[model samples]
Target: MSGARHREEDLLRGISASAGMAIGPLRRYELPLPRVAETAADPAAERQALAAALETVAATLESARHSADAQGQQEEAEIFDAHLAWLEDPALREAAEHHIAAGSSAGQGWYAALQAEIERLRQSESALLAARVDDLRDLQRRVMAPLAADAGAAEAADDDLDGAILIAREMTPSQFVAVAGRIQGLCLAAGGATSHLAILARARGVPCVMGLGEALLSLTAERAVLDATHGVLESAPDAERLAALVAERERRQAQARSAAEQACAAVITRDGRQVQVAANVGSAAEAQAAARAGADGVGLLRSEFLFLGRAAAPTREVQRREYAAALAALDGKPVIVRLLDIGADKQLDYLSLPAAPNPALGERGIRLWQTFPELFETQLDALLLAGNEAPVADAATPLQLMLPMVSDVGELRWVRQRLAARAAELGITRLPALGVMIEVPSAALCAVSLAREADFFSIGTNDLTQYVLAMDREVAGLAAHCDVLHPGVLRLIQATLEGARGRCPVGVCGAAAGDPLAAALLVAMGVDELSLEPAGIAALKAWLRELDAAALAARVPELLALDDGAAVRAVLAAWLDASAPRGFGVMSERRGHTHNKQ
Candidate 1:
């Protein structure tokens, strides 16, 4: 195996969980999960032990829930709430007590009760019920902490790991939060690219590489260069190597700044293909900035932001004003607003969502509207109100509305009926361009059906990739296989395109759209629009200019035929290297050679 521990002047490689480069001191932090012990014990002692463990787990959950609620992490708080309910379940408490009374250790009792409950839930017809097994597993870790042999060590440590390249065997979601700002880079022996740890790492703008293997765990270097852009960790690097890395980092930052400077221009590929580059903004201020940056338009408004950070739901007029302000900021450009995609990762305090062990598959997205009619109706009313009041010139901007988590034609028909009713009620003849988000595997498969009724299609690759591979993006263990480049995900995108044919405009607004590599591939996939974060607009624009659409499009069949993400990446990398046109020394120097032939 090529994976080896570097004692001195050597390099280790792993998956790039985040894109960036960091030079920092190496700090090792290990938070070992406590092991459950099963042993015979007196009924009295077992009861006492069980009670203590329950108290600790409950207190921890309640604290986290309250803290999350205060910090606008309402969605995260729901996760803790579910754990608290499980702890207070009468049946679960009774089962555990029975085991304790039977002379089982507290750990044994707790494990038995959790397993029995999970098994019962798994037998249910509902898929959400079956998914609760993960929640139960997460609870076991927290509950077992106080009961484990190393309970004292489970407590918080005093060391500060900020500004350090954190190395660990595995990191939980909580660990990422604790050392968030302080950690300049992250290296883990476990978890995958799309794990919760990886997600947080990226959000914090920290360079992170995971699934690095066992040798990295014992790394004791005081300082190292963590190049997460390419997933390379260098220890005791030669001076020459350090200088080269530093220079490369600077060049990338320069390129990023230049891309932003040229943000207002249209991005056309070398093969003469024009791609619409847009932004995903949450507020009017961001919308204004996107316009200044020269974005084609807003891709996703994340309308849930309107309902969050408040004690009650905002009035319909309140939503309309906010939506109107954002539309005005766009300066007549088209904006695609996805209505209230809450429940999984995003939640609203006013909405009473059922506690699900796995909320991602729960009553979220378009499902939330069906369960709560008023929610969807009010939002639709606001969109129509804002649309009708828009100026004649900007009215051509088209207030595009998109539905999320739609599974079947019935759901589309139901929402369309509501939209038409709202438009009629408002005495509006021209309704906005209505669209469905092709996120769920079902919608992708039934795209032709949805296209026949809808005005346009916006593919949400984030949820689509996760569901297509059956990998939860939040699960650290499943990160490796959660890539959008997976053949299955690409096939589904192709499926949606084929089914829709030339019937509707298709756009991609997920994280994939923001990625330069994925953005290139997406255009090659014949995607009409590419919506990315504001910051990536320039590089993506520059990156687009490097691509030959016909060259990329012609190889679509071969690329789709490849079953492995790694194979797909290799093909694209080779193509980019070969086809990259000669540019200023800035971009070409980084690639080591110019595209002289091109």
Candidate 2:
């Protein structure tokens, strides 16, 4: 239809939620909120009705949680957990009760209670907190649906949006779950990278961009190009522009396919040094994607996904199945499973640990594990059992267990004791290789001592940068300051490498590993492994084949002496420009300073 018209091309920029490119017809999707009517009611009866509606909604959310988990959507299941927590909040119930006592009906009281909280969240200083308003609204709708006089009031038929990029002011998880597989792409006028919708979009591999603002509403294009990688949407493109986009898309696809086909091979630099390029996966599905993308193995397997969203800690067999399935998906590739890393930031209702004023700087990761031995012992048992049942990987690619947020060698030693004890109890002869994640400044500073105990070391640059700069990654609009390329952060990385001192494999499994400039720098710094997102694997591999790692190693001192992240970026950009043949289009095109560019 777009080809039939001669329309002017217009480009709109927004925050990218997921990375990919899609061209399709535009379909505006609008989900109507369930309405509640004001009515006179007996206060006591209204209170009872409110209680019953809350329980019903809570039960529905619990059911959805189980269903999502069954379908391998652990993240979506976690969203329901948050909703359930809100549903049972005593303050919310008391607010509705007060309204009911003041003569409002149950539906009206509940609506008012939720709206007050939503408004408060919207006014919060933290953008991450404010972005949760849609989640609250979703709760409002679920509860109101059961409370509405007409039982079928909120029921709506699914739209035929297949092969179309759906645009909305904002979307709730409930609406997204219903049509996630049907939509080709997604565009939102309002949402940040931390929103539940954005998480779901990324998990589903949907090409999505959000926070497009009022400009999105004015888009009248019948067909458009959604380049989520760059957060650009080309609307109402003319024939020439459309053809160019189509060609570009095809070329990118072909390049990706070719790179992936060659990715499984060992990555040996021109100087005859071999480096492992791996993936950081959270689920079995992700592991399969990594294998397809030609990842050497999985460097960081986030085991926390299994623990979250559930009422109790996952049983040994349950965690074992999930872990084993992930290993099986990768055939014989190695997997370094990080034990439960939850704390105040990522709390489990079942685990009652001491309260901390600052969750980030307080009891978390290995500390949390130490505080609750029973919680982590089961996971250790699961890992041991999984390795036994899963496919036997290469001797060089043995299964590994990693400890998170370990600031000292004492914590690593403690975990090793527990893991060894668990393996013995499980009658396993050989223990899996144990490692530590160098996410904290203390850990990076003491990497040498940790490497003496740890079988390997994985640098989590995202957290390391945040910790080094005292900048929280969740704080919106601070992305520029929280850059991993900062000289201080790079110096810490250099220290980590020096600590390893060829004693063990030191890998970076953070944002830096996926970034072309950072990845190149890490390779030059003598990092033995680089584990990144699955999508970035192939392109990085293609680019690495053209790199002279030994030659780049000579330039490391120059980078380490750089004043700031911008200067470091400028230098890397120049190097990329000088090496024209090695310019992998996807990696060379920098996405610096992208707001909410998750």
Candidate 3:
């Protein structure tokens, strides 16, 4: 047995929670509660304790709710508000009291009741409700942890660390709220990025790594370094390693600042070609940040947030206020708003949707809008009001309307007609430039026809790639096929661009636009604009400036002749590498060499 095998080193890995490095003392937060046996004797005392516990939970939730409101995290606050309602529920309270009276310890009784209620909720037909049930179960575990020992007290007492690593088997949203900005990094034994702790980490910009197995058990309160970039957790690092990590961190931060500065600068090619570099924002705060980052305009303003949680469709006034806030934050910059794209994947209670055997192929985007004509009308009215109210000096601010999931020219015409009707009702002579997302293969195939009816095109690569490959991106097994760099996907994009040439503006707003190599290919394909995350804008702009579009155009035929996406990527990479310091159009030497092989 000894000769056959040996135990491997115990190494743990997990999804990187945030995008930075941090070395800090471990601060384990364990919730506090009394022993089960201690509270069994006195029913009245147990009742009082339960009431106090419920009040404490209410207070904690309220504090979180207020914090979220102050920070303009309304959606986040809703999660806490739901928890508050659960705590105040008469059924839940009665169940907990009954358990205590039946001789269970106060803490155990409360936890048991909550867990049972959560389980019952899990049987709910609503997926959102099921997700909420899971959240409640997590909260119950946190609320009862303090009962185990004095360890909970130590965790609660750790409110003053300079930099601390939160070690937990799993953390509740409320627990994370309590620690808030006090911690630098978080390491969890279990939990995925969708967990409340991970969500909070992302919102707060704190470094975190979860699903570290039992690594949290081995960690000490002493300083430990977490390299989120490489998914490495270094325990008790020596001075040299610590210094190196610190220096590297500083360098990365400097790079990030430099990137931000560069992102705002004008995106002019070396040969004097100008292209607008904008942000795809989902919220008003994001819009403001993107504008500050030098976004020429908002290429895509998602309207899902306004529709997500409401019991009924948002009124025109409410939508107008929201749209106005987003436009105002942009300070008159163009905000290209995409009407609600919600459907099967993002089901909303307000909308009556039939269950589809294949939702991806079913009604979504413009289809959903077509089905619910009133919703579309309300949205159009709000957009028109916002546009009219916007300052006249920014009249040419390019507030284009884009319809999502438009698979054919007929869909485009239908939407345009509706848009015209809405405009007539609003006493407007003409509507803003209307566009269609070239997401479906059918749209790409018939781009010219669609472009004839629409004023512009924005490629929604996320859905485009999914549809082209017939693969679900969220499914782990199909992730490799989800690559936007695939030759088939590129061909679709090229076709779309070719179809839209000279007819209307063509922009790539999907994740592919952010990739340097992919952006080069898009430019080579004659794409007019590339909208991406703020961080990638400067780098992309730099590459675009260096690129000789004429030279790239000369090489396009050779690239198209290639059958494989990987091969095409290789050829592009080689061309970029040979072109040194070429401006925003320069490609990596490695990528150029790879492409040359093709």
Candidate 4:
């Protein structure tokens, strides 16, 4: 021990989840559910107690919302509106009462009601609603925390999570919400950039860096400097380094503001190639933010948000109205609505799916359509009516319907046939242009035949990589192998592009499309469009504007011949280091980076 050298600031590099900087002590956050009994002596008293707890939660949300507004955190504040409304919802109130009336403790009844509501919402086709499960779960945990005998200790634990840089292996969206605005920064050992955790973090302006390995757990230093812009973590940074990073943080914020101001302008390459830059949004709030970010159109409109915090599937009218609102917000721009792609990562609890040993390969994507055709059918019906509504879609491009998890021509054909039937049933002559998500490896491999049935193709690189590699990225142990840059994954992309080249417009809407290096490769592979979160549009546009697609296109053959993702990444990195514009600060890392931008 005497001869051992003491390291000065251990450096940990990770993927940038959000852009910002923080200097604080590292704190770890962990929460476990409390055990509550089912029986109670006074049902009415239990119900009353539950109501009071809900009131407390409401006050908390309202205060946070107002704080967000006053601090100029409009989007972050808007996130609480739904939570506030959920508090007043009669249905939610009744569910908890029903459980209490059934002779359960107030805590147990509330927990049961919360679980029921989550299940009901989980079945929703709206992407926004589906994403709310975490928040709802978080709310449930909060209300039940103090119900235990150690309520005081639990509250103290919650308070301790504030005012520190959180270092975690993973955090759910709701957990992130609990510490959202209060935390200085966050570093996770695992999580896709496009995961809900990342999105929620960005909403609150909390800097996050994810995908660091387990080595992050070994750091003992309390004080550290976090630079999310570069995904760097420095333990016990010296004065000079800290000063430079702090200054860089200020410069980046200014750049972000300037970029947002001009986000609406068309993205044109230096050599004159105009590429369509659009936003992949789930909620209406995000849609508006996308417009402010200067998105050409909504490349992905997730349908699951409508299902959160309630038990019933959203009525057709509700779905139509929500879709209409999103379109109206986009002004006359085109919007591609992806049908509920729930299953696997996002499960529909109400479906009562049996415990599967391998859910990832089980009923997910198009496979869900087989077991629950009625759900997709109802959604399809809504899409037809909504698309045909005059106020919903003006002279702009007609709203497009996209089926997730289409693995073959047959699946694509099934939806195509169903669409035709739905249009006829609704007495509609014009049908929305149909598209399929090429997320499944089989779908990419069979893209040629699918092109004949579908009008367009949108590659979901995240799932495609997972399915092709047979590795679930959600599992922390397997995250390293779930990369989209692998040679096999890119080959599938290449095949899909080759098959759909002349037949339909092929685009990528996954997190990978947001990466500057991967975006270049995607362009090289003949992708006609790239969609990502609106926050990344300005940076990606700045980076893409410098190089010619033709120049990158010439390297496609060589890229495809690479032995592995590492080689592919290294080659792309070298190319960028040699060719990327020096003007945009678009320097590539030594080996470049991959993984979808969350």
Of candidate 1, the 10-residue stretch with the lowest lDDT total is 589-598
What are the per-residue Cα lDDT tens digits for candidate 3 across 128-202?
Answer: 344454467655754554443442544445554557877777666766766767788877776544345554665
The sequence of per-residue lDDT tens digits that candidate 2 reaches over residues 1-598 is 1123334347777776777778888888886666666764589988888889898888899999999888877668778887897788789999988988988888898889999999998876555567788898898888878777785754765565888888889888888888888888899898877788887887788888887777797676667888786567778777787887777777777777777788778887667888899988777767877887888989888887677656678898898888888888778778888888876356665778677766678888888775788888888888888887766545443578888898899988878887778878889866788888999999999988988888999998877888899987765446556778888999999999999996888988887787777787789888999997777787888777777778778877898789988889888767755764645464542234333321
lDDT for model 4 comes to 0.73
RMSD of each: 8.2, 4.8, 7.0, 6.1
Q: Which window of 10 residues has the lowest lDDT sum in candidate 3? A: 589-598
Tens digits of per-residue lDDT, candidate 1, 464-557, equal 9878988766454454567788788999999998888879888998877865566778888888888865555666777777788888888889
Residue range 1-598, candidate 4, lDDT tens digits: 0012324447787776676678788887656676666789998778777878788878888898898667755445655665676667777778888888889887887788889878876675433345466657766776776565465674344565567899887676657766776889999876545555666777777888887778887675567777675567887665665666566556656766666666777777655677888889876667778887788888898786565434466778888877877777788787889997666556443466545556666676667776777877888888888778734354424688888877689877778888899889999877788899998888888888989778999999987887788875544445455667888999999999988978999989987787677787887678878898777787676667776677778887898788877788778767766776664343222113444432
Which ranges of candidate 2 are over 4 A from the true structure?
A: 1-15, 22-32, 40-103, 113-133, 146-169, 178-185, 211-227, 231-247, 388-397, 424-427, 580-582, 586-598
TM-score rank, highest first?
Answer: 2, 4, 3, 1
Off by over 4 Å in 3: 1-59, 69-171, 176-200, 207-250, 393-397, 534-598
Q: List runs of model 4 lying over 4 Å from the truth.
A: 1-9, 12-51, 54-141, 144-164, 167-183, 188-197, 210-223, 227-232, 238-258, 390-397, 583-598
- In model 3, what lDDT does residue 255 have? 51
Show how many residue pairs clash in every candidate, following the order shown: 2, 0, 28, 21
TM-scores, all models, native as reference: 0.69, 0.82, 0.75, 0.79
